[model samples]
Target chain A: MAAPMKSVGSKLSVERPAFTTTSFQKKTRSKLVSIPGTRPSVQNGQLIVSTGVTSLDYLLGGGLAVGTLLLIEEDRYDSYSRMILKYFLAEGVVCRHELFVAAVQESPDDILQELPAPILDDIAIHKPVEQHGLPCGPQDSLDSMKIAWRYQNLPKVQSALASSSRFGHYYDVSKTMEPEIRQAANCHRFYFPEHPTQSSPTQSPMLESYSALLKSLQEVIHKGGFDGAAPMTKSRNILRIGLHSLGSALWGDDLCCRDNPRHSHALTTFLYGLRALLRSSLSVAVVTLPSHLIQNRALMGSITRLCDNAISLESFKGSERETNPLYKDYHGLLHVRQVPHLNCLVSELPDRKDLAFKLKRKQFSIERLHLPPDLSETVSRVSRGELAGAAMPGSACGSSTSGNKHLDF
Target chain B: MFTELNSILNITPDNFKQGEFVLISDRHTDGSFLIHHFLSFYLRARCKVCFLGLVQSFSHYCAVSQRLGVSLVQAKEKGQLIFLEGLKESLSVLIPKEPNTGSQALDFLRDPSAGLRSLYEFVRASVSHTGGVEGVEGVEGGVEEWGPPVLLVDDLSVLLSLGVSVGAALDFSHYCRATVCSQLQGSMVMLVRCEAEEEEDDGDEEGPERLLKGLTHQCSLTLQVQGLPTGYCRDIHGQVEVCWRNRHGNGQQMQKKLFQYKVHDKSASFFARGTSSAVL
Candidate 1:
């Protein structure tokens, strides 16, 4: 009644406040019938895995809406979130698609086993690991794709994004191309309504055009968008964009997590901008700051709102997965709790929900939710510079982009 | 993955309350049997009810529910046992919401014989077809009640001895919006008997001699209900005093009681190592 949990067409609705233009999209166009339960719009976008079951789409109001940002928030990493993400792997890999996982505090294997199909052919994973070295930024996304696409004078886009240890899997590319990674740049997708407008103080058209074009072009090439447009490009039909722990990435490689606000804010802005860039009907996913999300509940509400019409996944094997709330809200987005029969500690692709968990104190209490915006003005009245309810978990504080970027990355 | 974490995934009344049945089983053999009897009675009473035992129980329940057109969620593996297959799934549209709503289970039970047949048919059909509960065909197919009156069972002999009380348990069932039953046409009360291997005297149950046979042997079961207080309790060397077996073999009220003190003992301490549970 108060509007369903997801605001699917809200972006389009907001973008075109005056009229509903039908010709704008190649296929998708809507008047937005807001019913108690709205069925998700379905299209054969990139034909990924079918989740093996049809019921989850019903709860999702429809299957995982393509090109949507999934914000998995749990008090701790748990099975539900992990399973949900693995379901995507099954989707991406089995369907000849690819998944880019962004977990700053977990190891890839720790979560991969929870999925049903362990050998994820379509999954290009990125999980943080202290013991084992792994990419920690958008730079990684860039370097790997280049390596995957431009290997030994041939298009090896897939290998560039894939781990070198997996070179054996791609004997053709591994034999000729350089195994070393070229560079890594952290980013997901960007909403480019206006082409890198010079009007916005924060935006630089050159950087915007290069970054936006490069990221999308990688997928477009993966979509075979570059076969005729550019020579020496062979990647097509699969893409996974991961902004793994963008918040932490924003903090300098040296400073502790608590010390960098401006950096964090910029990272948040970059992510939101990417959401805007996703436009409509392009399938993509991003996983980031799960624990941070749970810790900053109030801020996450706005973040979740930003990721409207999205699916949230939990890393079941993460240290704190058991206590997270995402396990409950997403309705076991992964099926981790059912792994015993399969006789695997790690479930395989198609896990979309973790086990059930009850919180001693719900991160977002009723009172903290549905608060008015004037709280920010109240905070301003008393403080130097804090947004309304900035301290509150719902204030969307965790990823606030501090307009400070005079320094170097 | 099976972490040693003891977390929960599903609670009885979840966000989407289509239908849920939680089984709280006590390890004691007698207690478990008694609880199972009551549970079976409820499962029989409500077409929407399901009995989930162990692993096999989950599969059986899911299959049965599928047959009955009732949506059931069961996790197929051990690591994520708490995760159910269909709990978070949304198939309500597939299941009819208004399958001929009569508004009253009693008002429709006016025609006694047809009412009972319709109730059974409704259940059997649901178990057999996708839209069985809709009662489009077969028994339990009619909703026009033939004066189905509500009866409350109040005999202590049945409630205390077996550690089961159809009369007590039915209180929850009383909340049913509609029911299928012809024998219970005008009366809301029904007789429930414990299942056992009985030596039939080659006589129909319709004879008075059957009732006179009394109890042949005391049941070997003690019901241990958690979170329930024990009344009429006695202190035995090994048995829980709150509820115990009636020692008389031929007595109508016969039962089995477990004899053991929960000594500072690690007897079945194997399970104490704890199991994985989802907390989110």
Candidate 2:
């Protein structure tokens, strides 16, 4: 009966098939997750994670891209770079992301156990008062009204809370990490050279190689199901890989000291593979190297090239410039030699090119520098008086005669 | 004069960029006063700051900052300021009842790498939440926007005294620079003492001197502070020679300028040395 009714006017012919429109319409959904302090940015419809420091995310133009490798050239102190690595791993733990820590010098367990505890509680209690200044004046209330008005109309400032809440957590180094949180963290530690060598081997082939380490990392990443297409229902998790002191002797051999072609080749190959692995998956790796150890510039350059970002730290303690007054408050100097554009979608770039770092009891900060306040006015005043006196030495000497006359009376 | 200083440096939200390193060179004893000036400036600007007291105790720095007009206690309570006790770590070994014996303390002092590592970890954890989202939920209307964080290391030369090798110290400096430049997006002001190297050292060539040279080469900007020659000017405390290269512009051109500064009990002022002063 339905076919007979449609035969008169051919309703079926006029009606479009449901699949036709559905197939042509693109179902593009962008899922962006916030890393605590960074602006919410997406790359190819995926979210980027925070570097665990807001200022750093701002410097990075929006935190490290979802899948990129970050290489840090360690300062002689090595503590600062290691601290950064700790922040990376600690953040990973906080975000419930998978962490892979490869340590050459220290035990990975000790490093993990020593991971800083998040200062979320302190932040929660103090941030509101600190941010708004305790609603002291009528002007503040008036400003609040204006902000309310702005919040409704301005998209940039509308979701202030939403944006603020998306910031990373600060940790307390004095406090030990909670057992539950530490246990819940999806972390894997790889300590290179399972067994210590009793004596120096000219070429210990049995010792773990960079290639082997890379292979194991790849396998771990793959096994964790972080590779390939992300699930449709949830966003992809971030995978943080930390390579602590790569050029150090802990990673099989000191690539800096050894001229052996094999050692260099292994490092270069491992870096290449690691970079490739990072690109193909949703992961970020941070490698710390002591540039001082790497005597070969060409070798260091090559290593830097393999990574997406390269940063160098130099302390001024023994430098001729260390006596420079402007550096009086700094712990060290920092140079952002290179930052790769892994994602084409990000438009903002890091504002600073060179920075100084100061390490305090609780925090580390980098700042763009300007010449310290100029005191030319004071100098000029003094100099003007001196010049006037010098130009009229006779007059200056005679002027004292008048004062002496009064004293003589 | 405070406002004038602030304007000259332009350490405001608009001009101050995160990830900058500032090297402050001075006689070890004198720089602390100069550093207090910066601490007050940042704190006044509502910046979260961490002061690593390697040379002085936390209480001492706090007192100094307080005199400079920054209420360290209030700032600390607001979680906007933190004072890390670096001196304690090394001095702890000297305590009679402490677990670390004199030998261990000597060993720790001789090898500052371990202490530096722990200090680094502490700092990383302290500022991790800066601009973070954790406790922002209950914050009501009109949240004040804060400038980037600030870190002040009292004196870097302590590491040298602690027997941190020249290479290792240089490496540490490099690591600090990289960390701040790449991860913190904040500002660091490090104080280094420009003590004349002793002539008696035989094996190493003026270790501190060499280290200073290396740091100067790596730094973008170097400012050297020298006390006014004995009674050159009673009003002037010191002179600062600023050498900087604009990293953004050509990067080749280096600029040098000199400023004279006077420090009072609670305030400091800087003046450009007029040409007349040089002639005199």
Candidate 3:
């Protein structure tokens, strides 16, 4: 037997034995199915892993719906972003499906560095940089016009398609990358209307005009050329998305926040607008905010809702050496110390014997921060502390469990 | 026996064999990597392993599989749990695909978003083998323990890891099925904003430096070696202790090992310090 365990959608069909359920009514099946060299276990289900970034992937029990989003954030720096982008653009990401990444703030290069280490090569980063409003020529201009028309006209087609019954979270965010969006934003059709075989290269003035610009760039390989082969892909996971420094970008929209609805409202409007925009487009979205910039509680609540995974950035108190020199200060950088009740920080050295005695401070042992390994454990820990860092432990509603159970669906 | 899985999941195996495996994980971040590495390791030895939750990127999976030692399997469809038990009943042979021998660097070009599709193919082909004997079982989501066909591998080189997500230590607890208590448990999972313009070299950390920890784990031990054939594998054997200050002004130390280095060069195998060996 051969099985392609691709997405959450597929697992819905595996035969699970019917058993008395005390609470959750998740799908169950019972049967003996065999794949190439192994047997499926009816006992234990797959394990779930949280990227530890925060507020991201919690909905799918810590990832995209095995068939959907990965919720990878973006990078402010170009190289890092490229690294992030490459993780979704290159090869081996998936041998069976088309890969795509959409970035509004970061360019392709900006997304590359988002990976833990930058050797990732199989994903496709859908960038807006390439969609600089179609190509440039008569046919190209016409194509751009059509794309614009399509963008506006998409609502109607999508209204029907959306109504055709594919209900999920990614409906909105993915629309930007939908076939309809591409049909309206065709890069090839706008610029290359006349068959390159029918007309002389010189005859197309529009194409010729951009020739100088094209000269510097590596010409795309024409068909029939010995093309690069795609590497074998082995991806059996979620589509990760990262919204790196979105608040900073919106704040950077202008010189100062003076005239723009105050800093709080600006943040409020920014988050609400994007949140509405992405509800259907992406499976998951994580927007990180620098703690220093958190000026309002109301706006913070709305902004935090944008991501299912929420990690507060911990401020770096010591020299830059205390930090990974690669990236700048981020709230996500906080080293979360796991406890049994709620999440707590190994912060402050227990507020006792240090600072005055520098020598003793250097010897601070990491062993004192005894915590449960999992975040859920922290909920138990938090039940004891009840501080800002503590998490609510084991409540029917707040039972220290933060993961969304609906993802199993 | 796999019959134990009958109450937990929707799928189960028809028969129990010496070479089959069933893996399960709690909602920790590195759970996926653990399952992948375990599967790849077992599969290479002609054993089969099924993964439930989502895992890491293709490159990470490939790197982990190659490094951890498992038969390479990537399924991309949903409801695989539904069809899983059926696929395990008839398959009697382990088929080796082409050596995916891809480098970690190549992963940058790979599309992690497309991982689901491949996973789908892996699931579909396994259960629906037209004329195969079918007796596999599936574990419905969230019945944590007591769920199908189970493989009890004697050796687990690396325990379950949290994939850069918070609460990785807790995940490790579930992976090891044991608790890890630490005093100063600090971890580094997120990416840093390294300014490319800085002329600092990648390996030029003169003073103290933080390394990536095995996410979602508590370590009884963590250590690091300064040099290997490559430059001394950092976090070798995942034996580095992380120390941090707590609210009471007391220094704490957590016994968590973030990463372990596999001595690539066998000639250098004789070079051992504090029990450094191959990852497998």
Candidate 4:
């Protein structure tokens, strides 16, 4: 049905089905309805799957839509983002969905082996309930008399982990998922070093690894019966594609090297093609890009625009924020850059922009960032204002308002 | 089609002249709606259209246009539309098939250095065909007898992403303008993605910035879509800025107009600045 299909050979034309009936079926009668781990979004009726982190799913307005790509802009050290990717795979394994793991520097097997074990629903519900309980007793009653008393009846903001319905699972970061559990689902690996590269004399700027990855992904989608074009003989399953640390020098993209990278569009082009592939199939991909190293901010912006949903992790690794007592409870900041606006005019925006994630002993959780209240009676208003200024640099009015209150006193 | 949008942009069939180049650009927002508007606009004007849709699939455009009271399938069957699906073609070319020596429009997929001459030729062949002379629809209104051939590209930025240099992409569009616009008394419209300058940027022009500046200088009219400076809102989706440039002798006079727009499923509503219900 494609225009160029006429001029090209029959082999190329095999991809485009004669009847473009697959898309119309996508809206209401999608075969994806039968797939495990997917649910129709109440907002727009688009099929969605969790991103492993329930709070992240809530931030994205239900979950990542089927046939959509979720881009995770890596933190400075790439530690937290890696953990998030593992959560994604772990959730897939638990849901019996097939997994396609592609990586350049690290082996896909190693990454899969490190997936956090999913905690039992009862145990997952126990800890957060206690945490919520401890804050609601005499301490809250005593604190309610403070100047922020107006917010007392505003319905305690739901904790990120307090999911009303059991749609997603919480994982224990300390334990590796059992081998038997991990092996239950099908897993495809694309280790770049092992894949043979086609060294053409023409020397296209697009790296051989990218084309290899795309070919491998396309093959898996078609062969695994994920493409909706063909009727299913066997039961359908979702393919969870996890691509780790793309656009780095290891992938042969020069975007991270110089101000004006020669192959600036290489990563973006690959993403565009990759998105096209995902759109026509029963697949959901979570790609983690090392955006911190990318030299051109504008290129990063374009990359963000191309994806359906994008969130960037800014970890306080070596920065001053790490040592700042104000941010001691949080390990990093999670910036929700773009949320998918599928089948609708407006996307679901995160209720609060100031979000922080903490890496606890056995779990990783994202929570609303609230500055620890300055409760010392001996401390002066001037020092409190300075502390507020130091803690939240983005909000200058926090300190100025405190200063104004001091003047009135 | 979008009658309100058409009137806002003053897009009358006769208003567009031969050799006229219209550049549609967007920053910090999705501007594909403008491309859709122009697509059905030309089709409704009885103009033969050749669409090089790189961002989306044929079904997507077809489904959207269907809501706007136009059947892209019928148009394609009647030879009134020429659609080049870039997404499908790019993926197929990425597959390592037998290396043929033929210079197809997608030769750049096999060879990045290869220019877009073959793609340009494809457009020319499709638009230049004189279907009126044939007995098929010769008596009725054929493509040649209907209106001038118009070339529309959903986006040109993807060319840069596909490894084709900015200069080659410009040359490709330049040639299309010559053959389709100047020679055939038709018009050309291209959509380009331009990145907004960040605070830290020192205004050094290169890459997308340079390409946008180059295209802006050559095009007779520019339509820019930008997000609300204050941020997102419920009623107003984004703003559209239309600039008309008329060159006379040694100098050029420019007229600029701005409108706030909100897109719906079937149609889009465009209003003057400060007129949106949210703002009011």
Candidate 5:
């Protein structure tokens, strides 16, 4: 059966010798799997790579799979989602993968310059958690002595989420990635306002900016020799695409402008075409869409369905949650809208849905959402009892603050 | 081999569901598996099948079908299967090699107002032609001896994504029904994506919602696959709401049934609601 397929494939192509030999080598060698940054997922055996943020990768079932698109719904201010896009690109640079960055309002170069520098030393990588424990230094030991004698023998509750074998690196948000490190990787930039193929009056239903983006992505995939159908070159590499702030009015799309936008299918068509392009190539895209502004909820739903994975960032910058004492420890909530089920019937659902992310001084991390334990006596007895009951399993209430299990509780 | 699904769908070896329309719709969950089931089911039943695969490549369908105990390549070789690969054709439509020459099935890409006339023509030609390869052995030398043709569209919602208007899509399916179902006494199965959120907001209906509504009204059976309202799970993948319209008795009585399903690598199992092992 396999022999007949090989012969048929050879007969169809004029370059039969090269095609046959290359395909034979591809089957035997499977050399692409040996690429530096990629690893086959144990769950379904798909090639996966980091999303730059290790905690986020844990939420996304190892990482973004090759040839799949990850849709990031932008927060109200667009700050946190843009940070994620930068983390994705910065990870590509560290891994030496080729980069394709596109944006409408911001220049791709500007986005690249603001990427957080990756933390290198292992000691510094663990410093953020240790620093959180520094303020209670002198009193934590005393508080431990004051607890019941039987409970004193209990194991310390580690609060930090212990990540598995480190496939992704930690990034320090305060430091910008060095220009020298950023320039090490090959990068393609597409700023819509400055693109040469500005606005061609095409009969295609896709918006000019969107079609142009798709065409450019196609050229990058085919000409760069990332297409699976094309014969392999000397070396194979992954292409990381970072598209920022799509579906905003700046991209000539009106999905966010009105309740009944004129071009309702424009964004979805672009995504459809883009997904088709990505499926047959060695590329992964991280697209950040301003879904909050899009009035048509149904359109947003369709867009989410088109992409492989969809996540939305609901930051509490101006919302009532920002001022709530219960949520004081976190800056935003991360919703796992959709996870891809590729080559299998079931997807790898995240362990929990109530996940939150915070931007500490040195690092940004995502953690299972939890509220602080109420310590004051001013609270009523019934609510306090309830709070204690809810927080008992995972709480660092009496000041030990050391839970290293990533999914503690 | 999806025996459970077959029983729930009321499909039997001899019951070919002639002159009927089956609409498979999914929201926030993958419904392409239903397409695969119908594709392999018709081929196994010895019916002539025309599959309009607008989402994936030919090799993808062939690979999935091979696992389901059918050979699509062999089926195509024997003239039992007619496959239209929309992914490959759409690329050509986007970047036309020559000005006016291309696949007519995707003319809506080049001219949005042109609609799906050429696509419907393609389907009409495939199912009506009877002389190529004998789909069924001639028992009494009569055209009726041949097995009924089945038109399976992996998805019809993509046409809307490719700029084809909702009305054009409905018209395409309508004509397909007229030829494949009404005239030839064959069955037509189409897959569409419609998010359930549309029901909450009754103010304005979008393209997909309207297309789904239009197809649901015409179809004899409508199977809606949707994600769990609570979220993803380990045991049960999703639930299917099967609505059967009784065209014979007043055409207004609809039989609605719901079953939870879990899809495996090669086959899927259907169980009563809350009967999954995880629930136990």
Candidate 6:
């Protein structure tokens, strides 16, 4: 084992340490793991796992730190949230990490089948090497070829390297997930079926209570080797926990159901317990709650406060944005309500906090929104020579022909 | 075509950032004209646009684009313009015919869940075809790549009339907003029709009002379109009230401004109401 030496005078003195070289190396070095598509950030010596979506990882300041609880408030449709959950799970699968899916509505098998396939770019990486030979022709002299060789060795933009290393994969929604990979992945699924009416208060419950579910989840997580007590393995695997549609009608009653204080209390207790679990273990939990169902703003506020990060989706189809000519190309709006504070040393902090998101077939992106252009400027531009050609035809021809005809009639 | 409207909204192609959700609402049913005008603006600016026509037919939209001097066919050929047949699908659902009874067909037509899902699927397919998300990895030879495409929905209110629940419709809109406006770094424009008066007695108006409220709260910018009285002025076509809360501005306070617009043969102009005639 190679040991790091401390210099004594001009010569290096090989001082025998109390511990073994391997143990010393392990103690000194920070454990860093890479999550696909996102830059790995070290927080208190542990590597933060990537959220799977590159853009999202960028937004969250180099992916979510380990032991962080990310709360996603489900938008009206719940599709976007579901899509995000899939990306998270897919990322876990790709990294050979363990996943715990706490689903309330859909079965785990159905959800797994809908996972997006890993986008492979083997062709993209090989294309550049092939093209590198194209510039040198058979007719080229040795001197010219020598010059080309010199230029080729010069550092090119590292975008190709960057693209090749990107961990995010685009899953085709039309195709189902590959069963071989799905079976190979270490995924634990717990389905919490809703029980609308119970026969008796004293009788054994048909469905697991929120507290029982939280305890069972904790028990599973502890058994998954994420408790941080075991010796660091060469292959560090992250534990991803996803709670789909929490606080929805499927989860007993709505979180804001004041009439059922018992249910609401249980949910609050579960959230607190989940946060505690996240803080102690080498795991990340993504809990999605339907914002619309929780009418009580105070309760919503408390729930959001418990999580490290919170993002809510609001879909507005009102007349204001829908009818405006200026907004003719826009779809819906997105608001980044909260961002978790990172304690790590970051090179460049994400500047844009508030953003609007758009969903395409395979990709989702977030962008900083800007106000529409002033009306007076447009009118002025038309009057100026900028739009002179466009304005002349309308004013000179339309007035002369249509206005005169209208006046004549 | 959009100069007047763009000016009123304080947005120009150069300054308009990608991934903004702009809602255009018309009290009068002239939003189609505005949608056409904006599409022309995008096309003129050399921006790729995906038009989801939920209310108007694709041919009609194309004709309007042509009339506005936008080369729709060329744009389509160049992959700069894409049209999602939302209206066609919605019509198909409305006019379903099979061995099933009339009542059964009617029930299917009125089922908002299926219609909303199909609409969402149609939009996803169109966005994907345009290389919205999944195509980022495949960069070939040094050919000029298309920038993120702007998504334009003709009208979202049509989903409400198609028997979809307000919540589901709002959810779809939210999903679109989260995806197209936030994730794709693409601009999105959705048209919604607002009733001129609040009919408290009518239950039908309540859904639209709720939708309007929800959308208004989320949009960064909102332009209220209203047709001007016929005899008010020969030059002025209509009035638009622009309301927006500057995302970067202090305190998230909403700003409201009004402009009278005149749509001439080729160009449109927006002037401060008092100076409308003089500007024209």
Best by lDDT: 5
Q: Order of candidates by lDDT, top first? A: 5, 4, 2, 6, 1, 3
Q: For residues B1-280, write the lDDT of model 2, one tens digit per residue.
A: 1554555555564466667677777641144555766777777866667777654445445545554666787777566777765544433232223344433322334234444554565566665665543123224633344556677777665555444556766776677666665576777777776552223454545334566677787776776777665433435656777776677778588888787776554565678774333334
Go through the candidates in order and give each one's C-alpha lDDT.
0.28, 0.59, 0.25, 0.77, 0.79, 0.59
Q: TM-score-based ranking, best first?
A: 5, 4, 2, 6, 1, 3
lDDT of 6 at B52: 74
- Which sections of candidate 2 miss by over 4 Å? A1-46, A122-166, A173-176, A195-207, A229-236, A258-262, A317-323, A345-348, A374-409, B1-280
What total of clashing residue pairs does each candidate reach? 123, 68, 266, 0, 10, 52
| RMSD, one per candidate, in order | 25.9, 25.6, 28.2, 7.1, 8.1, 26.1
For candidate 5, the docking band is acceptable
lDDT of 6 by residue, A177-238 (tens): 68898889888887766323333332111124564466567677667767656566533456
Candidate with best DockQ: 4
Candidate 5 lDDT, tens digit per residue, B123-167? 988899874444433346533323788999987887776678888
Q: State the TM-score of the second chain for every model.
A: 0.22, 0.79, 0.25, 0.90, 0.92, 0.80
> By summed lDDT, which 10 consecutive residues of candidate 2 chain A come out lowest?
A1-10
lDDT of 3 at A225: 17
Chain A TM-score relative to the true structure, per candidate: 0.37, 0.68, 0.32, 0.82, 0.82, 0.66
Task: Evaluate residue B130 in candidate 5 and report its C-alpha lDDT on the 0 to 100 scale.
Answer: 78
Question: lDDT tens string, model 4, B1-280?
Answer: 6788768666675565566788998887777777777788888877788999877777668756765777788777666788988777767666646666333667776667778878888888888876474113533554345578889998787777777778988888888888887889888889988775534454665556667778898888898888889776657778999898987535667789998888876688989889987668
Docking class of 3: incorrect
lDDT per residue as tens, model 3, A1-409: 0112222324664434456465455443222221111112121122222322112222122222211222222222222223222323321122111222333344423343222221112222122212211212134334445445555433221100011211111111111222332233111111111213222222111122122212211122112111122121421222223434444433233212322222323333333223222221211223344434444332333333223334332223343323432222121232221111001001011121110100011010011111222335445433333332132223633432233433324
Interface RMSD of 2: 26.8
> In TM-score terms, which candidate is top?
5
- Over B93-174, each residue of candidate 6 has an lDDT whose tens digit, in order, gives 2222343333222232334345366556655555655543333332353233456667788767654544455687677788
